[model samples]
Target chain A: DVKVTQSSRYLVKRTGEKVFLECVQDMDHENMFWYRQDPGLGLRLIYFSYDVKMKEKGDIPEGYSVSREKKERFSLILESASTNQTSMYLCASTLRGGQGPKEQYFGPGTRLTVT
Target chain B: DQQVKQNSPSLSVQEGRISILNCDYTNSMFDYFLWYKKYPAEGPTFLISISSIKDKNEDGRFTVFLNKSAKHLSLHIVPSQPGDSAVYFCAAMTSGSARQLTFGSGTQLTVLP
Candidate 1:
């Protein structure tokens, strides 16, 4: 079974504080992604990394950044947490090469509350 | 602009009945569609997927139907049990787009006993 684990299940941060969310996948997938789920907004991609040290901005990358120093691990960083940034963050990974759709496996998720 | 849309914010169905959830997409480039189930405080899980080449795909009690001409799709859960209740999300992606999927606002499904 593919397993994706996140560093924390829940977190609370003050405004202007830096927050870091970590994710690790055991399946050795080449592609990793970060997404935030908000009420009525669904899941919006924040950032994605296809290779080590390579990252691309997603639709909602303005307040978030990502890091992929190694293949199996990915990290999401909030330069300064704000009230508007409080939402559930998710990490997903998928294999690189495939003819059809590559379904992404997601971590349990990190619920961050910015106060 | 929302490429994918799940218009129904919520749906309620009695147990042992069929629950149909609908989704629509505006992007013609999308050739693959998927459905995901998510619970409160948990990440969404892959439920089923259908390719554009085929109009229907089924797995046990779950069946996904795709209509390319209308740019629409629906998921049918037959004999839906209480356990099947969750937020269902519709997602789509083009084959050439680095496997990035565009997701729709989810529909909350409730199965009453």
Candidate 2:
């Protein structure tokens, strides 16, 4: 079975501190995404990368940045953590070929709390 | 505006009854719809999917129906069981090459015996 591994399942950070959440997929999928999920709002994409070193901004890209240095790993970074940014973060990967291969596999989310 | 919407935040059903989960979308360009089931801490998993070309798709006890005219889709679970309780999310993707999916706010389903 394909596995998507997250660096941390729970993270606690101080306000204004920088935080990094790492994700690695073993299936060699070319597309990787980062999203933040809140109570009422659903999973909102922060950023996504279709290929190594190529990234695109999603709807909610205001406070988050992402890195995809290698094909298997994608990382989400919070420049300055804030209280409002405290939420569950998820990483997903999909096979990169074309439209029909767009099935996404998600990682166990990381819940972050900014104090 | 939310591109996709799941109006019901929660739904309760008897264990042996059918549970219907509904979802609507405002985007006309969306051509593919998918349903995902999520447990408490684990990430959402893909349960079933239907392309815009087909109105209905079934996998075992789960069936997904799509209506393009109304811009709506629904998932029906037959003989709902306690183990089937979870949050369900409906997602849509347009026919473009990149294929980015837009998701609706999930609906929590509870099955009682």
Candidate 3:
């Protein structure tokens, strides 16, 4: 079975604090992504990595950063956590060499609360 | 601007009936559409998908229909079950462009027995 696991199921951080959320996948997928889910906003991509040490900013990358130093691990960093950053963070992975639509497998998600 | 939109925020249907969820996209570059089902405290899971080249794709009790001209897609669940109730999101992606998916706000579906 394919599995994507997050570092934490729930997290609480203070404003202006630096926070990191980690994700690991056993599928050996070449692409990984980070998204934040909010009510009425669905899921907004924050960052993605298609290869180790390569990162690309997504639609909502402000105040967020990502690291992909290893193939199986991806980490999302909040430069300075703010209340507005409180949301459910999701990590997803998909195989690289696919012609048609590729399916993304997601982790259970990390619910972060910033105070 | 939301490239994909699920206008209906919620939908209620009776068990054993069909449930149709609609989605619309504004980007003409999109070549693929996908639907995901998400439960509370869990990440969304891939439900069904349709390629731009095809109009309809079916898998078991789920079928996805795509209309290229209208840039619209719909997912139909036959004989909806209680376990089928969840928030469904519609997503679209452009070919050869980072493979990043643009998602909709999502529609909460309820299957009442």
Q: How does the DockQ of candidate 3 come out?
A: 0.83
Specify the highest-TM-score model's number: 1
lDDT of 1 by residue, B27-108 (tens): 9999999999999978899999999999999999999999999999999999899999899999998997779999999999
**Number of clashing pairs per prediction, in order:** 0, 0, 0
Q: Write the per-residue lDDT of candidate 2 for residues B76-103, one digit (tens) a residue.
A: 9998999999999999987654557788
Write model 3 residue lDDT over B57-108, tens digit each, in one string.
Answer: 9999999999999988999999899999999999998889767899999999
**Model 2 misplaced regions, further than 4 Å:** A99-101
Q: Which pairs clash inside model 3?
A: none
Q: What is the lDDT of residue B70 in candidate 2?
A: 94
Candidate scoring better on lDDT of 1 and 2: 1
lDDT of 3 by residue, A85-111 (tens): 999999999988669878899999999
Model 3 alpha-carbon drift over 4 Å, by segment: none
What order do you get sorting by TM-score, best first? 1, 3, 2
Per-prediction TM-score: 0.99, 0.98, 0.98
Docking class of 2: medium
